[model samples]
Each structure stands twice: as structure tokens, then as C-alpha cells.
Target: MEEAAIGDAALFHSEQRLQQAARVNDTATIRELIWGKVNINARNSMNRTALHWAAMAGHERAASLLLDHHALVDAEDKFGMTPVLLAASHGNLSTLQTLAKAGATLTARNRLGQTLLHCAAVQGHPSVIRYVVEDLEGIPVDDPDQNGKTPLLLAAESGHSDVLSLLCELGCDLQAVDKESNSALHLATRRGHAELLSFLTSAICSDAQNQDGLAPLHLASQAGHLSCVRTLLDSQCQINALSSRRQSALHVAVERRQPPIVELLLRANINLHLQDQQGHTALDRAVRSQHAALADMIIKAERFHARSLGANGQTGELDLTLRHVGDLSRVRSVLWALATRHQKPGDWKKLALHWDFSAKHIQALENQWTGSDSYKEHGYRMLLIWLHGISSLGKHPIKELYEGLVEIGSTDLAEKVRRQANAEQEPARRCVLM
Candidate 1:
């Protein structure tokens, strides 16, 4: 029994070495192993024969030697990957030809239902892709895998523009989508392939949404792909296009802490008033995330747009793309400190009333409820919104801030704010609403 165990161990080591030899195309060791009467079709832990390794590595000489020794040509691995399928997947045209000539089925699919054409297209193997679709004749170029992703869709998912071009030339559907309804354009944007996204945008509509109702712009913004976002915007995609959750690209960008993307989107004519399903605007997201710079940016843009609208409801041509924040924005930290620390729970509403804020604006500011500390958040938002209105009218925020505090009967608080304002830098010194 011990001798039998020793023989079994010798054969196991020989098989492992045979697999290693086939992997590196060392045919001498393979010949020696074959002559020693080892099983040519011995499978490893993954049920992969030596032919799978040779074919996967494109070792044509090793593959042919094994086949000549009566190796199984159509042996299926754990993934149902045949030798021919592995050869095609690795872009081994010559090795694939050898397997095909050995009567290996070219149209065989893996467990995911991916054919030779699908595999070749995904790996950007143009020659193998053409050979499988044209020479095989039975496989369809638009054949979908288990996810309903055609070769073109897979090429897009893999970010292979050349493969996509070839697939398009071979009559693969440019408009093909995966099971999630993600088109080639959506997939390209999700992967942040700007060049591929640019090519795909021309062929597909940017308004197309996936199952999540997320447009390419939304994905681009959330992924922080600046070039992709620029490409989508330049392609005439909708700027304010909302998702299934009623969240715009701005909302996603803010929630995902994408400041540069938020800056870019703010340059466009986006609607700041658009709320998500949870009734949170992009400003709400920025505030909740405690990002003061991003919140101030959105406030500046929001105020600019609100002021630009005329009585006839036509928007003005004011360039809101100025990269720098103005004088009022510099006082944001002071305002936030006052709102969160100094002011009482109901003091912000009283200050808003003193500033003559309409019921609608007050209601919008008071919509969210985040426990007892929610009052502080509400106070900060109210201060920022008031600052927006004052800055838009070219009035001084510091002077108006003191007068509003005094009118709300916070006389000592108003004097302290005035002293703090005077202590600030030149930018805050420019606050002249006095």
C-alpha cells in the first residue's frame, strides 16, 4: 500500500510538472512525461487539462504535441471553457486554428454562454474575432451572454475602442445594451474612457438611462471623470436630467464629495431648486457632508441664477463661471460658527423673518429633520441663503447681517458680529451693506 501511494505521488508530481511545462511551452519535459506513460488528460484542481493551459498561453507547439498524443480536443474545464475557446480568448490565432483543425467546436460557449466571438471581442482580439464570426459562420456577431451583453457591449465594457469599431464594421449593434439597459455610451462613461465615450456619444443619444435612470452625465459626475463630463456636456446632453431618485448629476456629485465636478456642473445652467426623492438638494448634501467650500460655491451659483431671472422670466447672460469665490463667501466660517454655536434654536427663523424671507423660502429651508441638532443645520442654510440674496443685489452682507441680528432683538450678538467682521481680512472688509 505504501508503494502504491508512492507511485500515485510520483504521477501527481509528473502531472503538475506537465501542466507547468505546457504553460511555459517547454515541449521537452512534456515529451518525456508522455513517454513515461502519464495520463495526457489529467485534470488539476480546476478540472483544467494540460491543453487548457497550453491553449490559454497560446503555446501552439505544445498544444499540437499534446493533441498528437491523443489529448482530448473538446475537454471542458470548470467554466465549460474548451481548448478552442481558451485559444480564441487569448488572441492566439494560430493556436485557435490548430484546435479547430483538431475538430474542436468553435461555437462552444462557456458557463456564462460566451462564445469564441464574445471572448475574442472582449479581449480586443480583432483577428480572432473576425475568424470566429466569419469563418465559423454559425456564431452571431450580436450574440449575447448571460447578461445580454453582445460582443459590441462587451467591447464597450472593456473600453476597447478598436474592438468596438471592428464589431461595428462586422454588423454588431451599436445600440446594444446589457441586461441593466446600459448602452455602450453608458458603459464607456461608467468606465471613465473619455475617448471611447466621445466616440460612443456621437453614435448614441446621451439621454439614454440605465435601470437606475442614471444618464452618462450622472455616472461621469459621480465617478469624478472631468474629461468624460466635459465630453458629455459638449455633446449637448441635458444638464438638469434627473435620475429615478429625482437626483440630478449635481446631487450625485455633491453626495459623492466631488468638488471639481460640482464646480464644472455649476458652470452650466443647472437648476439648483431640483430636489431628490428625499427632498434634499445639492446644497443640502454639501451641508450635511460638512463641506463648507462646496456649499459656498453652490450658494454663489444659486444666487447668481436667481438674480439673473427677469420679470419676463428670461435668464440673463451673466457668466457664472468665475472660479473664485467673492467677498461674502469668505465670511462663511464666521456665519457657520454663529449659526451652530451662538444662535438659539428658533433664532434663525426669527432672523429670516427680519430679512423678509418669503414663506416658500423658509419652508424649503426647514424641510429636513435631523434630530435636535437639525436646528443648527437649518440656521446655517438660512444664513447662506440670506447671504446669497444680499450678494446678488450687490449689497453688503456684514452690514445687513448686523442689522438683521439687531432687529431680531439680539443687540449684544449683533455688536459682537460687527467686531468680528472688522477683525476679518480685506475680503470680509469689503462687506459694505452698512
Candidate 2:
């Protein structure tokens, strides 16, 4: 029993040395070990043979020597990574060629069902990828692994622009998706690859959605990838494209608290009125998520966009910034104070009626329910919408506010609001007074 244990220990030592020698490309030491009749196929702690080390390190000559000594080229490591897979993953074209010439199965897949082409694409090796696709028989460029991820998708996920370009040039399917139905564009956007996203958007339809019905724009917006979001918008992707849940990219941005992306989408004339499957607009999402600043921005955007459409009767893109919206920017605080501090519950609906606000407009504003205080938000939103319309026509907001309040029988409140509007306070003082 003791002798057998000694023999096993000696074999482990020799195998460790052989792996070490192969790692450093020490051909002389490897040859000496081979001459001593060391077991070439013996595995170490990770089940990796010496050939695995040689192939991974790109030691072409050492790999050739190991193959000639009848080493197991297809021996899988603990992760099922064979010598050929190791070579391909490390971008060792010469070592891979050596393995291929030694009767190694070039099409052998790792445990994840990833082939040499998939590995090469992930590693950004165009040459190795080309060799695998062009030289290896029956190896399709669009072949999928266990997760249905093709080499093109893998390359896109890893942000390998050159490999992706080559794959596209080789006629790989540009619209191919993985098991989750995520396309290369979706993967690139999720990973925040702006340059790669630009390339992909130019190649494929930017509005292509994943299994979740999320387009690249939706993913970019939710992930807070500002450049990627801009790229998708510039590519003319459907700005108001809804997901499976019927949520637009705007809704996703607001829900995820992506302010910059939200601001960018608003500039593209995205539909602020788009409701999710739960019937919540982007503004509703912002309000529900307690993102007060984001909610305010959406309200401002919605008001201006409506005004622009009503005035022009044209649906072309319009920048909805505060500057483009006009004089309402000056009295935003006065309007806020009127809605939050002065107006009572159900008062906004009466004001809406007085201002000729359509039932649809009133309903849209009241759609969000956040308890009894919901009326405060509803009134605030309605006030902004009314202010936008009045400002767009170049009308005096103070005069309009006084008239609207009198029509609703709030004459006393109207006098106070008008006085506040006419007060010659500094900008800081105005904010404090409101």
C-alpha cells in the first residue's frame, strides 16, 4: 500500500513538472520528461493535461511535441475546455493549426457548447475566426451554442468591433438572436458599447426588440447609457416604441431614474402620453417612483409638446426644452404654489373646465392615484398644461390666472396669486415667497 502511494505521488510530481515545462515553452525540459516516460495524458488538480497548458500559452512547438508524444489533445479540463478550445480562446492561431493537424476535433465544443469560432470571436481574433469558418468543414459562422448565442452575438457582447465587422462581412446573419431573443444590437446597447452600437444600428433595424419586447433604445435608456441612447435616437429608432409591457423608452428611463437619458429622449419628441400595460404614463412612473425632478421634467415636456402640436397641426419633431416653451418658465414657482398650497381637492378639474381643458386632458392628469394627496399632483400637472397653452399664444400668464380663478369662484385666491406674480422679488426671493 505504501509503495502504491509513492508511485502515485511520483506520477503527480512528473505531471506537475510536465505542465510547468509546457507553460513556459521549455521544450528541452519537456523532452527530458517525455524521455523519462512521463504520462503525457495525466491531469493535474484542474483536470488539465500538459497539452492544455501548451495550447493556452500559444506554444506551438511545445504543443506539436506533446501531440507527437501521443498526448490527449481533446482532454477536457474541469470546465470541459479542451486543448483546441484553449488555443482558440487565447487567440493562438498557430497552436490551433498544430492541434488541427494532429487529428484534434476542430469542431469540439466546451461544456457551454461554445466552438472555436465562438471563442475566437469573443477573444477578438479575426484570423482564428476566419480559419475556423473558412477552413474547417461543416462549421457554420452562425452556429449557436447552448444558449443559442452565435459567434456574431458573442463578438457583439464582448465589444469586438473588428471581429464583428469581419463576421458581418462574411455574411453572418445580422438579425440573429440568442435564446432570450436578444440580438447583437440589443447586446451591444446593454453593454454600453456606443461605437459598436453605432456600427450595429447602421447594419440592422434599430427598433428590433428582444424576447421581452425591449428594443436597443429601451435597453440603452434603462441602463443609463447616454451615448448609446443618443446613437439609437440618431439612427432614427422608434422613439416611442413600447415594450411587451407597453412601456416606452421614456417610461423605462424614468423608472430607472436615468435623468440624462430621459432628457435626451424628450428632445427627440418621444410620446410622453405613452402608457405601460398598467396604464401608467412616463409621468405616472416618475411620480410613483418618487422622482420629483423627473416627474416635473416630464410634465413640462408633455405640456410643450401638446402646445406645439396644437399650434402647428404638424407632428414633426420639436425640441421641448424650457427655453422653447416660452414665458411659463418665468412663473413656474407661482403656478406650483397655486397648485400645492392654495388649490383645494377637485379644484383642478373645475379649473380645467374653465380653461376649456378637454375631458381627455383632465382624465390623463387624474389617471395617477397616490392616495388622497393625489389631487395635489393632479392639480399641479393641470396647472402646468394650462400655463403652457397660455404662454404659447403669447398671452399674459398673470392675467389669465386671475381670470381662470374668478371663473372658478376663487376670486380671493386669484388676487393673492396675481399680487405674487407682480411682486418685484429677486429670483431667489421669488422661490422663497412661493
Candidate 3:
């Protein structure tokens, strides 16, 4: 047993030396080993023969020497990688030709089911890619890896533009879906590969849905790839495109804290009221997630959009903020007076409900309290809510509220607000952000 163990160790050391020689292109050392009758098909622990190492190292002469001694041209290591596959991955064109001529299996795959084309694409080896896909009479360029990723998909996913371009020229199925049902375009957009994604623009319908039921636009937005998002949007992708869960790109953006993307979507007239599976609108999501600024921005955009649609019977380009800043200040002041004078329970609630403070928005504001005089706080919140709506309509919110007060017999507060607006200087600075 000891002698056998010793013998095995010696052979292992000898094989390591041969592999080392092949790795460094030491042909003379390889010749010496072969001359000593060393097994030409000797495999290392990974079952990678010296031929595999020589092919990977681009040692065409060493590979030829091993082939001359009857090395198994199709021998695969533990990774199921044939010598030809390694040669193709290294862009060893001459070695690949030699292996092909020797009847090496061009159709062989690794344990992951990745073929030479897949390997070449991943390595960005255009020459090897050409040789495998063009030279081989029946090459399987569209064969998928274990991940169901084709060579073209791998090239796109790897961002190998040259390899990807060649595959595109070769007419590989651009719309072929992977195991995850992710088309090359989906993978490209998900990876933020704008150039590669652009290359796949020839698909009849770019709205191919993946397993998650998200189109490329949704994935691009969710991934926060601004360029990809713009590209998809320009492709005539539905701005309010929803996922399987009914969450639009706006919802995904807010959930992921992508404020700039949210702004872009908002300007595109995305449906802010479009709720997701949680029954939460984008603004609701923003507030729930503590994105107060984002929530306010959405509120501003929604009101402005509604007013822009002329739903309120308003028209023309009135500057909502410039016209309403003084109005807002006076309304806040009047609310304090009304709360103090009326001293009525549920007045703030009536005002908030009357001015259209969303139940959710008013609830969020009410969560922050200081004593029993919370009506004053709710009324103030209501005034701010009214201000946001007024700004959106591009009208004077304070003036509208002032008129309502006069009709309700709050003539004293109404006159005070009118006097204040007349005393201001256009108030441009106060409403610049609005």
C-alpha cells in the first residue's frame, strides 16, 4: 500500500510538471516527457489533460505534439470543458483550427452547458467567435447555457459589443428569451447596457414581458438606469406601464427612492393615482416611506396636471405660486383666528375634508401632535393642502379661500387677507420652487 501510494504521488507530480510545461509553451520539455512514454492523455485533478492547458495557454505546437501522441481531442475536464472550448475562450485561432481538423468535438459543452461560442462571447474573442460560428458547418450559435443564456445574450449581457455585433450580423435570435424569460433586450436594459439595448431595437414589439411580468421599461426604471429608461420611453414604451403586481414605473421608483426618475415619470404624465398591489398610490408610497419631499413634489405635480387638463374649468398661464404666495400666508393666519374664535370641535376635519386633504395626507399630518388644540394644527395643514392645489391650478388659492370665507360670513378675515395680498411685491421669491 505504501509503495502504491508513493507511485501515485510520483505520477501526480509528473503530470503537474507536464501541465506546467504546456502552460509555459515549453515544447522541448513536453517532447522530453512524451519521449519518456508519459501518458499523452494524463489528466490533472480537474481531469484537464495537458492538451487543455496547452490550448488555453495558446501553445499550438504543444497541442499538436499531444494530438500526435493520440491524446483524446474531445477529452473534457471536471468542468466539462473540452480542449477546443478552452482554445476558443483564449481566442487561440490556430489551436482551434488544429483541434477542429483533428475531429475535436465542436459541439461539446461544459458542465454549465456553455459551448465554445458561449465561451468566446464571454471572453470577447471575436476571432474565435467567427471561427466557431462560421467555420463549423453546423455550429450551434443559439444554444443556451445552463442559465438558458445564448451566446448573443451572453455577449449582450457581457457588454461585448464586437461579439454582440457579429452575432447580430449572423442573425442570432435577438428576442430569444433566457430561462428567466429575459430577452437580450431585457438583460441589456436590466444591466444598464444602453448601447447593446439600442442594438436590439429591431424587435417587432419591444414590450416583451419577463417572468416577473415587467417590461424592459419597468426593469430599467426599477434598476435606476436613467439612460435605459429614456431609451425605452423613447421607444414609445407606455409611460405608465405596470408590472404583474400593477405597480407602475413610478411606484417602483418611489419604492426604490429614485427621486429623479420619479420626477421624469411625473413630467411624462404618469398616473399618480395608479395604485400597486398594496393599494398604495405613488404619493401614498412616498409618504409611507418617509419621503416627505418626494410626496410633496408628487402632490404639486398631480394638482398641476389636473389643472393643466382643464378639469377645473380654468385656462391660461397664470403663475400659480406667484399669484398665491401672499394668499397662502393670509390663509394660515386666518385659520389660527378661526380655530381660536369658533373654538369648535371637528372644524379642522371639516376644513381638511372640504379642501380635499387626502385622508392619508391628513392622517400623516395628524400623527404629529402637541396638546388638545390639534384643530389649529389640522386647519393649518388644510390651508397648506389648499395652497398645493391652488398652485397646481395656476390660480390664487388665498383669493379663492378668501372669497369662500366672505360667503360664509367670515368677512373680517377675508378683508384682512385681501389687504395683505395688495401689500405684497409679486412675491416671486416666496414661490420660486412652486
Residue 7 miss distance in model 3 (angstroms) = 4.5
Candidate 3 worst ten-residue window by lDDT? 315-324
What are the RMSDs of all candidates, in order? Answer: 4.4, 4.9, 6.3
RMSD in angstroms between candidate 2 and the native structure over all alpha carbons: 4.9
lDDT tens readout by residue for model 3, 237-266: 777778899989998888888877777777
lDDT of each: 0.84, 0.84, 0.76
TM-score of each predicted structure versus truth: 0.80, 0.76, 0.73
Candidate 1, 1-434: lDDT as tens digits: 99999999999999999999999999999999999998999999899999999999999999999999999999999999999999988999999999999999877999999999888878889999878777877898888999998989888888888898888888878888899999999888988889897788888989889999999999999999999999999988999999999999999999888988988888776788899999988888887777766776776676566556633434444333322226544578679878887888888989977776655556556666778888898889778767756654556677778887887789988877876776675664444543
Q: Show where candidate 3 strays beyond 4 Å.
A: 1-7, 290-293, 310-357, 364-434
Compose the digit string of candidate 2's lDDT tens values, residues 185-228. 99989999898987787778888788889999999999999999
- Residue 76: error of model 3 in Å? 1.2
Question: Which candidate number has the best TM-score?
Answer: 1
Relative to the true structure, candidate 3 reaches a TM of 0.73
Query: How does model 2 fare in lDDT?
Result: 0.84
